[model samples]
Target: MAELKEARVPDIGDDKDVPVIELLVQPGDTVKKDQGLVTLESDKATMEVPAPFDGIVRELKVKIGDELSEGSVVALIEPAAAAPAGDAKPVAPPPQPSPASGGGSEVAAKAAIPATPAPATAAPTAAVVETPTRSPPVAFDADALMPGKVPHASPAVRLFARELGVDLAQLSGSARAGRITKEDVQAFVKAALAGGGAPRASGGGGGLDLIPWPKVDFAKFGAIESKPLSRIQKLSGANLARNWAMIPHVTQHDDADITEMEAFRKKGEENKDTKVTPLVFLIKAVVAALKKYPNFNASLDGDNLVLKQYFHIGIAVDTPDGLVVPVIRDADRKGLLELAKELGEISAKARDKKLSSADMQGGCFSISSLGGIGGTGFTPIINAPEVAILGVSRSAMKPVWNGKEFAPRLVLPMSLSYDHRVIDGAAAARFTAYLAQVLGDLRRLLL
Candidate 1:
C-alpha cells in the first residue's frame, strides 16, 4: 500500500512567508522526484521548490500568489512504496532571520530529491489530507517580529524596511492575514516621519515614507478599469524605485571618435560572417577596462565591498512590454565575432519574449544601447547590485582636429552612471575615458 505524505515548503534560505510566484504542478499529476512543484519568488531570486520524492500529487494546499513559510503544507503526495519515511526528510523549521533571498535560515542551494526512481504506473485512488500545525508564539523582540510579520512584502519592501530600521509591528497591516503590505509600510513611515519619529534606518532597515500612490478617479472618468501588473513589471517597478530612491546616482558623459573603428568595419576584409558594430567594440573595450579596474564590476555586501573578477556583461534589449537584460557570461573570454553572434541571438530572443528566466539572471555590468534608436546620450539606471551602467548612443559625424586640420569624424556619445557611494567621480570619468579610447582604437579591439 502506498503511503500518503505531506509535501511541506522546504527551507529555501533564511526567509519566511515567501510569496508563491507560480505553481508548476497540480493535483492528480505524476511528478518525478526533484521536478519543480512550485516557484517561490523572494526579493533576491526566484527559486523552484522540487518534489522530495516520486509521487502523484494528491492535493494542492496552496495556489498561485499564496504566501508560505517553512513547514507550510504546499501539497500532499501519495508516495511510492520505496519512498522514505517522513522522519527521514523532516520539514525544515521557520527561519529566525531571513537571508537576502528571504526564504529561510538554511539556504537550500538546490532542492533535494529522493534517490529512488519513480515508477511509471499511476495511482488514481490516492486521497489528499490536510492538518494544521501550531504557530509559534509572537516574539516580543522588535527586529525579529518586524521581519517575521513582513514576509509577504516584495524584496524591495523588505529592503526598504531594513534600511529604515522601522519596526513593522508599529504599522497596521492591510493585506489578508495581517500580512504587512508595501503600501501599509509606506503609510506607517510617512505618519512616523510627519510626527517626528526617528529617521528610518539605512541599508536593509529603513522605510520610505509613503509618497501617495498614483490614483485615478474612475467615478469621474466613468466606466474605467485597471489590471494588476505582471510579475516582471511588478519586480521591475520595485527594483527601479528602490535603486533610484536609495542609491546616489551620478552621470558622466563623454564622446568617442570612432572614425578608425568605422573605417575598419566598412573594409570588412578580415572575415565574412563576423560583422562588427560599435556596440561590439564597446563591449570588448569595457571588458578590457574591467580587467584593469575590477572595482567597477563589484557589488555592495552590507558594510563590506565585494569586487568581482569575472565579467558577465548584460546587454539591455528592448521588448514590446519592457526592457530585459540578457547576460553574455565571461565577455572577456569571447572574441568580437563570437560576442556579436551571441548578442544577436540573445537580443532576438529577448525581443520575441522567448528568453527564459535563467537568461536574465546574472551580470556584473550592463550596457543599455540607444544608438540603434538614434539617441545622443541618456543616463540609464544601474541594474542593482552592480555599481554602474553604461549607455551607448548613436554615432554622429562631428568636426574634430585630425593632427593638422579640422575634419569631420564619426563620434559616438557614451554615458556612465555610477553609484556615488562606491565609485568616485574621477574613477567614473577615467573608466568612461578608457572605454572611449578603446572604442576609438580598432587595433586593440581586434587583438
Candidate 2:
C-alpha cells in the first residue's frame, strides 16, 4: 500500500504571496525526494518548491502565476512502495544536498525518478523534467545556481539574457551579491553593439551568420612554397586582429605644413655620424599637442577615461619580421636632438633583433610613419592601452592660398586614428590641428 502526502512549500524567508512562475510536474509524473516540483519567483529572487519524498504526482493544487506562501500545499504525492502494511514507519525524506558536494549526485537521483513530464509549462521548447533549479530564491550566493558554473542570476534575468543573446558569465553583475539584473543584460548588449567589451552570445559575429573562411590548396594553382611566420609577426597579428575587431576605430585625415621644420631637419642631416630626421621634430610637437589636448592621450578603462600625465610616445618601426612599436619614455623631457639619437639607436636595435621587452613598454601614444616608404595617407591601428596613433604620410609641396595669393609649401599628410570610445571626432580634429600648428612653426612647441 502507498501512503498519500502533499508536497508543501518549504520555509522561504519572510517573502509571502510569491507567484508560481513555472510548474515542473503535473499529475502522473514520478519525482525523487528533494526534486523541484514548482518554480516560485519573488520580486528579488527565484526558487523551486522541492518534493519532500520519492513519489508519483497525483494532483496539482496550483497553476502558474498563482500566489504562494510558506507551507502552502503544492502537489499531492504518492509515496514509494510499501513494506507489507506496517511499512516499518513513514520513511524520512532524503536530506537536502549541499550545493558543492551533491551537484553531480543530484542529477543521478533525479534521473532515477520516473520523468513522464507533462507538457512544457514554461514554453513549448522549455524542458520540464526535474526542474534544474540553480538556486533557491533566498540563496543569494551565486555559487548555488544549477549545473557547473552558470553565472548567478534570477530565472527571469537569465531568460532576459537569453533573449538578448548575452552571456551572463562574461558580465560582472552590479547588483548585490553579484546578482545579474535586466539592466546589466541591456548594458552588455549595448557595449557589444558599440564594439567596446565582451562579445554577443552568438559567437561574436556581430549578429552576422557568417560563413567560415574557405581553405584552398595553393599548390594546385602553381608551384608554391610555404614558410612559417616569425614570432613577432604571429604575436602582433593576433593583437591587431583583436584590436580591429573590438575597438571602434575612427581616422581623421589632415595636412601639416612642415616646410620650416623640414629645412631645419635637412640642416642637421649634413652630419654623417648624427642624423636628425623629421620624426624627431614631430615627436616634440606631438608631446606639446598632448599637453594642449590631454584627452587625445587617454585610454578607456571600463566606463572611465584614464588620462595620462606623462608622454611616452611609441614609434612604429617596420622590420623584415613585422611591425613593432618601441616606446620612447618621457618624451616631454627629451629635446629634439636627444630624441633623434634615441630613435636611431632603437631603430638599429629593432632591426638587429637587439631590442629588449623594456624598450617597447609603457606608451601613452603611438606614431606610424609611412612617409619614407611613400603613401598619401593611411590609417594606423591604435596600439591598445594607448588611445590614439598618428600616421605620417609622404611630404609633398602642395600649393596653398595664403589669403592673398597661392604659395607652394611643403605639406605633410597625417592621419590620426583613435578609439572612438575615448576621444570624440571634434576633440581628435582639434588635437591634429594643434599638432600641425606646432610642426609648421617649431617655436609654438616651446609653449
Compute each candidate's TM-score over C-alphas. 0.54, 0.60
Separately for all candidates shown, the number of backbone clashes (residues 3 or more apart, or on different chains) is 22, 2
Q: Which ten residues in a row have the lowest lDDT in candidate 1?
A: 124-133
Q: Cα RMSD to native, each candidate?
A: 23.1, 12.7
Q: How high is the lDDT of residue 406 in model 1?
A: 91
Task: Let me know the TM-score candidate 1 reaches against the reference structure.
Answer: 0.54
Model 1 residue runs over 4 Å out of place are 1-206, 218-230, 269-274, 445-447
Cα lDDT tens digits, model 2, 1-447, are: 466788899999999999997777767665667767788888777887899986677789999889999999999887754322122122223334454444233433432222333354543113323454353244244342232335656678876765565667677889987878899888877776566765534444543323455789998999998999999999899789768866889999999998899888888777777788888888999999999889888887778889998999999999999999898999999887788889999999999999899999989999999989999998899888888999999999989999999999999999999988888899999999988999999889776
Alpha-carbon lDDT, every model: 0.72, 0.78
> Which candidate's lDDT is highest?
2
